[model samples]
Each structure stands twice: as structure tokens, then as C-alpha cells.
Target: MTTALSPVDPDSYRALMAAHPGGVAVVTTDDGLGTPYGFACTAWCGVSLDPPLLLVCASTTGSTLPVLAGRGWFAVNLLHGAGRRAADAFAHRDAGRFSAVPWRPSPATGLPLLPEDAHTAAECRVHRLDPVGDHTVIIGEIVRTTTTRGADQPPLLYGMRRYATWPVP
Candidate 1:
């Protein structure tokens, strides 16, 4: 049984989520065709380690969701501080996402990994996809991982509707 509310207040929900900081990442993949697809995602985390699993949340209605589902593979590119530009570019609904950004396909999963803007990249195979509300939870089993940051640049953090870096103390 499910309770149906009369009206859903999205503003308050948005405000609540916005109050918490989240690390940014770009999820990229390609269709069996030559076309590539990607998007900026903030809802991500690792769920297990023995089998090496992680999860990323994306809108079920996003154009790239089908590509990810069909291919059963994707790359999670952890964006560094310098990747805000790339994040914004991918956030928009358009083609040519990789036109200006430098990227390469992951060796393990053949998913697109942005080396130019990402601090690290993880190639994963889809373990399962669970649809929750308006979003799909992509549970992945990490097959390959690499870091290009050289332990210097920290990943971008999004909070209060802005991009930032972790504070140095």
C-alpha cells in the first residue's frame, strides 16, 4: 500500500537536499552506435567492497539512461576542482559532450572516462538497476579503477547551489 499525497512540495525537498554537500561525478557511456552520452551526477556512493560495488543515481527519463542500460556498462569519473566546466557542459541536454573534453574509453568496460577533468575514473558493469521514484539507482560492480589526480586536486563538491573544494585546515 502507498499513500498518495494531495500535493508534493518540490521546493522544500530541493532546499533540504541542497543543504547537504555532495561530491560531483560524471557518468559516461556510449550506445552500440557511435554516439556517446553522459551527465553530471551528484548522488553516488560505494555499497560494497568484497565484490567491489558502487551506485549512481540518475533520472529515469534522461536521454542517456537507455544507453547505460543497454550497454550494461558505464564509467564514473570523479570530477576534480577544475572539472566544474565539464560538469556544466554535461549537465545540459545536448550532443557533442565529448567534442571539447578530452576522454578515452575504459579498458575494462569500454565506457568513456574523462581524464582531462576527472581526478579518478572507475569502470563498472551494471549489477542491477532499481527505479526509485523518478530516478534509477545504478548499482555497479567496479571492474577497473584509476587515478589521474596524482594526489593533488581534490574532487569537486556541490553545496548551496555552487561548486567548491574541500577546505584545507
Candidate 2:
């Protein structure tokens, strides 16, 4: 069960959110005719284990959202420290997001994917889109996954206004 609450203090909410470490990821999609689009995201969440669902939140005003709308397919690249440049480049509104990065298609899913060196990547077929507050929740069914480091590599993490990681000891 859940309870209702008053409007949050924006500053306090921001601070609280910053305290929580989030794994960095980049969501990408293409028009399938050469035009590609994507953005850096940290709001990825797994929704279900039975149906293999994943969720990602994106702003309505973002550049990639338009291209992704109703496309029914996308790829999520989990970033490591080496992917910081990729994350920054995709965060912009330029039309050259894919061109700036080296990428290829997933063999199993035929979805456009990043090069083999990312920590991991997943190809997803979108299941639904839900609007919540200032963002849209993108729900996708994970069709295939490819990984180089699996759980062994330390992922790029963001917390308290910076990037971070804690290697397994």
C-alpha cells in the first residue's frame, strides 16, 4: 500500500535523489533507414522477471524521444568508465549521436547496437509508453542481451553530482 503526500521541496528532492547512486546507460533507436537517435539515461529499471520487461524514463522534450516514438525497438547500452565520452556525446541534441560513436547491429536481435566493448547492451521491443509528471516511462520487452564484462566490470555510477564506482574487493 501507499499513502498520499504533499508536494516535495524541489531542492530537497534533488538532494535526496542525488544521494542515490544510479547506473548510467544510453538508450538508442534508429529509423531503420540510417537516421539514429539516442540519449544518456540513468533512470533504467527492471519491471518484471516473468515477462522480461524493462523500464526507462525520458523527458518529453528530449531529441531522441521523437524518433523513438512508436518505433517498437531500441537498444540500451550499460556504460562503464570508458563510456563517459559516449554518455556525454549522446546527451546532446545534435543529429550526429550515432555518427560520433562506433556501433554495429546485434547479431541475435538485428537491432542497432554499440560496439562490442561496452559493459553490456540489450535489445528491446517497446511494449508501452506511460506519461508520468514531466517524463514518459518507456516499457520494453528485452529481446536479446550481449555483454562483455557481465557483472564483473564496474559500471559507471552517478551520485551526489558526480560519477563513481566501487570495484569488487
Candidate 3:
């Protein structure tokens, strides 16, 4: 029962996960200087309901990681099926990601909110940050949430190294 298995290579692991689809979200934060930072993320999920906890994994080398860790707050903008462009914009690591994306500040925490692309947005206070391998798992306690789009709208998804939309019938 305690047989040790060989570690999987990075490329192999990536290939395995590419078969599993997940919803897309843009994780955003500010540098406390009015400059915003964000990245398109698929590694996120709800953790608990009682305390309203959710987790999003940020790349260790990502630019937004330091800012959000220092600021102690962030926003999660859940993309709709029509938000492929916004997702693509933030997916790249660059300083101009926000130039084309229309956004406003969240009411509660003043974090960047994707008003046009996001179907649902959550403002959170960072509860814990755990560094795991090449990514840091950010656990957030949801402070405020907003639903900007209707339930009939499908969610944007990523899998098989491509972007796809959930089939809503």
C-alpha cells in the first residue's frame, strides 16, 4: 500500500490536465497606486460555504502575485462564454492587459472588476497564501460578490489547450 511511485514530468502533467476542462476567471489586484494587475486563471474553486472561502492558484513568477500578497486583497472576475477576448488579453504576461479590457472598481474593496466580460465577480480578503511548487495557492474569504450577467449565459472554459464555452440548453 505504500509503494513509492516515480514523479511525473512537467510536460506529462500538463498534458494530463489539458484533458480536464475548467471555468475561466480573471484574478485581479492593485498595487495600491491605482495601477491594476490581473491574469486569466483556470485553477480556482470553492473551498467552503460556511465561511465563504475560495481558492485561486497564482503562478509563482506572475507579476500580480507580489502586489496581491502585499495588498491583502483581490478580485475574481468569472468570465462568460462571450469573454474569450478578455481571457486572452489577461492570459499573457504584460503591462497592457487592462488597456483593452473594460473594467471598474468593485464597490466594497475597490479592486478591479470586469464589468463587460465577467458574469460574476467576487471581492475577497486574502486569508492565506500557500506556496506549492511553481504556484502559490491563495485562499480568500469572500467579502462581497456581484452577479452582472444572467444565469442563461454560459461560462467560458479551457481544456485540451483551447478555450471553449459550456453548452447551455
For TM-score, the strongest prediction is 3
Worst 10 residues of 3 by lDDT: 145-154
lDDT of 1: 0.87
| Model 3, position 24: C-alpha lDDT score | 96
lDDT-sorted candidate list, best first: 3, 1, 2
- Give the whole-model CA lDDT for all candidates, comma-separated: 0.87, 0.80, 0.92
Ranking by TM-score: 3, 1, 2
For 6-102, candidate 1 gives per-residue lDDT tens digits of 7549998898888998999999988956467999989999999889999999998899888999988888999988888889888888787788688
- The reply for model 3, stretches above 4 Å from the true place, is 1-4
Model 2 CA deviation exceeding 4 Å by range = 1-6, 108-110, 149-152
Residue runs of model 1 more than 4 Å from their true location after superposition = 1-8
Model 2 clash pairs are: none
Supply candidate 2's per-residue lDDT for 30. 76
